[model samples]
Target: MTHPLRRGAAYAIGGAACFAAMSALVKTVGGDLPNSVVVFFRNAFALLVLLPWIAWSPGKRASFSTRRPGMHLLRATTGLAAMYCFFYALSQMQLASAVLLNYSQPLFLPFIAWAWLGERPPLRIYPAVLIGFVGVILILKPGMGWAGPAGIAGLAAGILAATSMAAIRRMSDTEPAVRIVLWFSVLGTLVSAVPAAMHWQTPSPTQWSALAGLGVIAAGGQLLLTRAYALAPAAHIGALIYTTVLFAALIGWLVWGERPDMLSGVGGLCVIAAALIVVVMRQRGSRTARA
Candidate 1:
């Protein structure tokens, strides 16, 4: 059998890459369109993509037969809030800074789970989380040119995103992946409609294409992230999601000519190292648990 952690790692990594692409698209489109409008199309198109899957997958009929509507509702609402925050941050800051701040979810997962699910993590993760945040500081260099308020907004986005993720972890215990996604999609579309309508701007054909692509990428990432969290504890795979930053850095550099200085590079390494330490130690602990 494939080890659960490894499988979860694969899903998390896949989700990270998808998210990275989506972030790029957000930045690309956010220049011309409002963030709320982008969020609306993102959720709407994601549901449209999921429609066929929910219809065609084997045993898919049962995907919506969920008893945990409240959980799904909560997850969707929190997720929608996070989506707004993240896209807003993306619009207001450099792609790398926004992504780095948002990926700080790994630092908050353990505490959120402890408070919400009573899952106390290993003490070792504490230092690892601190190191990851330190990496974030290095990346932001707060006293430097990184915009003061926008950077803080990005940090808030990460916390809200982590809260939404923890809700996903709990729902995954009893919910099919499609069901969870369906609820979020439907709810996000509804929640974002008013705001999107208020700020609506007609996208050019090229921007429309980008928005559609964002939706598809968002769907894939959501499914993968939900599956990964279902297969293991949130903290176990949370670190793997940091790979999104590296991917974001590549996109930022090539497409936008943005480059992080030496200090930021060192900080990125620290963040990656912190996450790797957690993953490796978690793997070792998993072996011990299995024994």
Candidate 2:
């Protein structure tokens, strides 16, 4: 691989690792806390971490002013909803399965973009979408016990995440990464606080530490992913993002003895392949337009 691609891959895989670890932490402590509480800490503590950096840099601090408050709120609301579903899925399902379902966000991105932005996708993407859904079906097959509430929650997370991503794309031309992340953290904390307060439960000291670490780790993952896209086109290195699934599977096996069945394993492969195809096709179309 070229140097840029290599660096992008490293950042992407590192981000994936951070996310996998964060999800593992959530699964570990999620039983003791409400999903709202978990979501609150995830956003609140992340904002805390970001606050210091903003304070340190005048330029970064100035970025707090945005003309598109509505867009930011939309992103935050959708992202927070996605987080709630994802956290609930993590608490109720096997680690790898929950992570895989969440990572399926890319599959829905094209359709979301088309509907929201009027950016129609290429015709070839239809087959890729079909393949991805086949994988979803296999992974959520009736016998797998994953077709229940938790499965629906996991799937909802992916769709909501796609919507959040589309909002991000709409703002990408005018919003820097720091500003986007900051607003999301701020709004996410405030919005989630309501439900968190309603379902409030005091956490033990150890749990507090875990929750703090969860937020910090998540911020680090976001930074790594942002840098990855900066270094290379999403198509060239986007496939590496799926490493989160592998890392999650490893954590699941080691910590919980969770091994995927043959069908689910195949399903995961299909999903990964379909997502890759979608990414590559989009990249090529963008290049053709430029040419």
Candidate 3:
């Protein structure tokens, strides 16, 4: 790979690792706090950490300007819902399962683009999507009656997250990425505060440290993801996000003593394969279009 591609890959991997760590921390504090509280603190602290950059840099003003408040609202709402479902499902189910299911978003992205944006995906995208679904089935093992509500919620979270991502792509044409992220943090914090207040459990010092770490880790991850996308095409950087699953599995094993069963392992492999295929096809299609 070229230096730029390599750099992008490294940044993407770093982002994925940070995200995986955040997930593990959240899982560690799963029972001690409500999902709302967790989400609130995560976003709130992230926003706090980002405030220095946002305040000191005059360049960020254009990003906050509103030529598209409606789009921002839609994106933020979808993002909020996605996070809510994700945190809830993660709290209720195994970490590996929730992470695997949520990572299926890329497989659904092509169809969502075709339907919502009127842009047809390449033929290979369909088979890749089917393969990803098979992977999900493997993880869930529904025929053996192992699937549960947490799995269903995770799927819902994936769909919502996919939708939000699609909207983010569209919004990126008009709005800055930082603006979208800032709005998401702002809206997420506000929306989560209500429910968090209702189920408020004061965090111990250790839990507070974990929550703070969650915020810092998530903020760093988002920055790295943004940097990666800026340096390379989405197809190149996006597929690398699958590394989060492996990271999640490893962290879960080391920290929580949670291990995926044989089915989940097989399913995770399939999902990774499908994601790689999608990335390859997208790159080829882009090259062909340029040629």
- List the RMSD of every prediction in angstroms: 3.4, 1.7, 1.9
Candidate 1 ranges with C-alpha deviation above 4 Å:
1-15, 60-62, 222-240, 279-291
On residues 102-212, what C-alpha lDDT tens digit does candidate 3 reach at each position? 877777777787798876789877788788889988888886866688788788888888899889877777777667777777877888889899989999999999999
Better of 1 and 3 by lDDT: 3
Cα deviation of 131, candidate 3, in Å: 0.9
- Model 2's alpha-carbon lDDT is 0.89
lDDT of 2 by residue, 1-291 (tens): 889888998999999999999999999889989999999999988788777765665564437789899999999989999999999999998898888888888789998999999989999899998999999888888765555888889989999999999999999889877788888888899999999999999989999999999999998888789789989888866788888999999999999999889888998898889988998999898899899
CA lDDT scores, all candidates in order = 0.81, 0.89, 0.82
| Backbone clash count for every predicted candidate, in the order shown | 0, 0, 0
Ranking by TM-score: 2, 3, 1
TM-score result, candidate 2 = 0.95
Clashing pairs in 1: none
Question: Compared to the true structure, candidate 3 yields what TM-score?
Answer: 0.93
Rank list by lDDT: 2, 3, 1
